[model samples]
Target: MDKKITNYIIYAVFIVLLFLSTLFKSFSTDVLWPKDQNAKGSFDGIIFSDPQDISGLNVTRTIFKENNKNLVKYDVSFLYEGDFGNLRILGNPVSQIFLPNKMNPVFSDVTLKGEYNKINNALFQENLKLKDLYKKVPDHEFSTTSKIRVPLDKEVPEVKFSMLYEPRQITHGLKGNIAQNAVFVTNARVESFRDTTKQEKGIKNESKNFQESGYYVNSIEVINEKQIKSISFESTLNSIVFIISLATAILLIWLDKNKSQVPLLISMMLSIMTVSRFLDKGATTFGILFIWTITGYLASLLSYAITSEENKIKTRDFKRSIAWTLIFLLVNIIVFIIPRTF
Candidate 1:
């Protein structure tokens, strides 16, 4: 094959790979907030469950703002099939419930329903009118916990459980600063458990004693009209930065196709990506994209340095660079994207 033809082929492959990386990253669900003006917040979490005992699980979260306060509603549903004697479920601490400063819980309610012996039954239900449960913790922050119990029979082979709750949290100004319209962020930890106590039908036994558990987080966001507008504006600025940086990197490579220039181009790209992290707060997508870009650039630079001349780049150097770049890209996709995507 002609050396020039091989070099062109390598460039074409590089462009395709770059395009695919950008497209995939842009569509990643890791970006919690959408560019849409109506998007108020995002929810994402992993549910760890015993494959042998639990068959399926589903979780949903909803957020609402009323009376100048932000309220979060959570719905957790799951299916289990196993001997009741072997079943165990545990819950994590509900510390994330207190957010946007200390919040006096307007109300904390829990309702649990399940099926036993092929018959629909209300296993456990409770509505705690928690005026006294709400107490100030350290730092003068108010916190509360809701407890519910579901009585189960050991002979039952299959059970489906569903729980729902809504807790109203006060929306204070951003962390330390007080603003008229500030974005409120919080998360909920919902856990599934089985009754392990020898006793039957008690709130303390239901809430306090359990083992072998699975949990998930429901991230809540409450933003007013003005805060939503600010998010939209920031997103626009991020888009502009992304475009300019990408264009500049490509232009530099096209104008000066020398191995010596690769390092400078890579530095410029990294700087732009780092700046992107500040433009959008708490965004992991930018970090992931930056890592991917850096890996590719470093791999190409290494390959070029090993194969190229001091004064000029050759076709073989380009081909070798593409080979190493592809290897690095594969490693990145395996290490980062695979687990997140799956």
Candidate 2:
């Protein structure tokens, strides 16, 4: 019934909310990257298939293959499932192959390979700049697209392809009988010794009006090796961020308990920035970083407003404050950790 008690209750509720936010924001990162290990590899070639003709039948397929190899060559081959009928739907195909980049094992052949080390050094310098940018930017803003090129020739003789059986339960009419599997081919090269264009000639002979496969050959590039480091604090300076956040939290909790608002507000702001480190994993667009930063500040603002409206600090009041705080803490725990369990 006392005004001081009521104020303490409200202050306790907001402080508890802050703790809950801190504890559960990590869950968003989990949702962004699956823990099941479903994604095939950390480094691999990219394979794509499009029912829609967005890449232009042959040109897109060639571009896709080249990018796959240039970025990294997977031990397995890549495949594209073309829709024989429709020619407009264009998007990244299902299944991603992660292979090593050309710079891996970090050693070059002793024999002269025409300034291979110099070229690699230049590339490494460029990669360093990119990595720096990646750290400064929030995780949500990272790009997902991969661009590569692979040379098709004698040494790289056989093209390998992989296919998955689409059960009739889901795609009955589209994929038809289970006996016929979707086919994807990799490492396809036109033989130099044989009549390489024989298939085109045959198709033309049958139709009396046939054109080359409508796919043009572009220059091929190969990625000899590549690397993907584990998700860690080394790159993001996360340890620094974490230290700053914890210090800020402790300092604010102390200052507010002693009846000082300024230090508390400053501490809250720092904690918000600290949490922003994890946002890197989920953002799809550049604008997401801005959004997250704004949300962090907004949370801090709400904390300030709630405390100001309620004059007495929770630490000063004890019992009623603890009860009120527990309600919020319980709610956040239920919302974040409980539902997924069921």
Q: For this target, which candidate reaches the highest TM-score against the unseen true structure?
A: 1
Over 231-279, each residue of candidate 1 has an lDDT whose tens digit, in order, gives 4465567677666655655454444454434553353334334343333
Clashing residue pairs, candidate 1?
89-193, 90-213
| Residue-by-residue lDDT tens digits, candidate 2, 230-288 | 23433256547646655665555434443444455444444444443444432222213
TM-score of each: 0.29, 0.28
lDDT against the true structure, per candidate, is 0.34, 0.30
Off by over 4 Å in 1: 1-12, 19-27, 33-222, 225-230, 257-264, 267-294, 297-342
Please give the TM-score that candidate 1 achieves against the real structure.
0.29
Q: Which candidate number would show the highest lDDT if scored against the true structure?
A: 1
